[model samples]
Target: MVKLIALYRHPEDQESFDKHYEQVHTPLVEKMPGLKKLEVTRIQGAPMGGEAKYYLEAAMYFADRAALDAAMSSPEGKASAKDLMGFAGSLVTMMIGEVSREG
Candidate 1:
């Protein structure tokens, strides 16, 4: 499976960011092709220094790298990606990567 990890920093106004995400970003990402599952989480606590490093995070799961790649190549993906700019101030870091295991 492959997952796109989107780490959003604390928004200038967190309330607005949460509202907008539910009203806009979530729906937009949900409509993208090859989206197996979509999860949004609020970051809390410290992964390492007893302090939280991020404000929000999202995990978009895909069937595999090919599906994820195809999604990124599609019109919806392209548009949704561009829409990310709308939340520029609320974004800290975003990354997409793959994971697999041998048995």
Candidate 2:
């Protein structure tokens, strides 16, 4: 499996960010083709208990890198990309990786 991951930095307005994410961004992402699964996490604090650097983490699962690329090239993906740039472009870090689900 392959995964597209996004690490979101703390935004200036947390509430507004959350609202747009849940209401608009999520739906746009869900429309992506070849999406196997989507996992979103709200980061609370570090192991030492101060605070985590990132505010949220989103992982989008795909069958492989090809599927991921195809999905990202689709219309839905284009819309999501534009919306992302409008909102969290500067505050987000994104990566693609191969997944190993073995123990």
Candidate 3:
């Protein structure tokens, strides 16, 4: 399996970002092929107790890299790309994501 993790650095007004993610982004990605599971989390607390970095994190599970690539290249994928700009306009940083998983 492959797990894609996206680190979202959001605007200070998190409610707006969360709303966009739920109402717009999440659904677009959820339709991608090969996705076996999906999860989204709002980051909270700094274990190091300095500054909390990152606003939210999302994970998408795929059966394999090929499957993931197909999804990322599909119509849903194109829409996902367009949707990103909505939050990215307000974001400090947005990470593409790293994929990993255990068999």
Q: Whole-model Cα lDDT per candidate?
A: 0.81, 0.96, 0.74
| C-alpha TM-scores of all predictions | 0.85, 0.97, 0.81
* Residue pairs in clash, model 2: none
Which model, 2 or 3, shows the larger TM-score? 2
Q: Write the per-residue lDDT of candidate 1 for residues 21-46, one digit (tens) a residue.
A: 88887888888899998888887778
lDDT of 3 at 16: 79
Best by lDDT: 2
Model 2 alpha-carbon drift over 4 Å, by segment: none
**Model 2, residue 103: displacement in angstroms?**
6.9
Residue range 8-93, candidate 3, lDDT tens digits: 77477768777888888889988887788888787786898755677777778777778878888999877886788756655634
List candidate 1 stretches off by more than 4 Å: 47-51, 101-103
Q: Give the Cα-based TM-score of candidate 3 against the true structure.
A: 0.81
- Best-fitting candidate, measured by TM-score? 2
